[model samples]
Target: MTCSIFFSTELPNDRPQVSGALPRAPQRWTMEWCVKTPDGRTHINNSRTIQRATVAEVNAIMATTINGIKAEIGDLATFISGRLTSHGGTRKNRKGGKRR
Candidate 1:
């Protein structure tokens, strides 16, 4: 399943009615993300929220999350590259020509 994450500038008006853990620590704002699967169904059946005191902190968290995702994609690319090259396979360019 392919999944993507995005930060919304506006809160969803028709959010699903679900309760989550309240922020226990000192925090002024909460950032939320909804994970949806194919057919437009929520993956977790609920929105995930994280509490942070400042927008910078939330942005930092988002950056870290994005970086982690990039790392995972890199690993997957490496694995696929190894597999493709394992059986004497050659890399192909967009024009279907062998890549140097």
Candidate 2:
């Protein structure tokens, strides 16, 4: 599994547009992501864009994403540790018995 973070200033056609529509405020920022797997599976977040987002606003987004990733990693590590410990410890010999 791989992950990445990216930033872009351009908004896609789906974004609201009108003859007199004012440009997005400086604080407004757009964010999105798409993923395709080898098996022709795809995933995307269509409504993740931020409105009237400022530098601080964007920073907050980044911080929250980073924190979430960190928490998931920590949880996975703990799960792995628990699984290993429960299965006759990490080092085992044949017949599912602990090794000397």
**Candidate closest to the true structure, highest lDDT:** 2
TM-score of each: 0.29, 0.31
Q: Which candidate's TM-score is highest? A: 2
What is the C-alpha lDDT profile of model 2 across 1-100, one tens digit per residue? 1112233223354232222222333333344444333455544443343445443455566556534544744533211100000001132356857556
Give the distance in Å from residue 76's predicted Cα in candidate 2 to where it truly belongs.
7.6
lDDT by residue (19-69, candidate 1, tens digit) is: 333333434433343333334443221222343333345446655653554
For model 2, what is the C-alpha lDDT against the true structure?
0.36
Q: Which ten residues in a row have the lowest lDDT in candidate 2?
A: 79-88
Indicate the residue-level lDDT of 90 in model 1. Answer: 34
> Model 1: clashing residue pairs?
none
Q: Pairing residues by index, what is the TM-score of model 2? A: 0.31
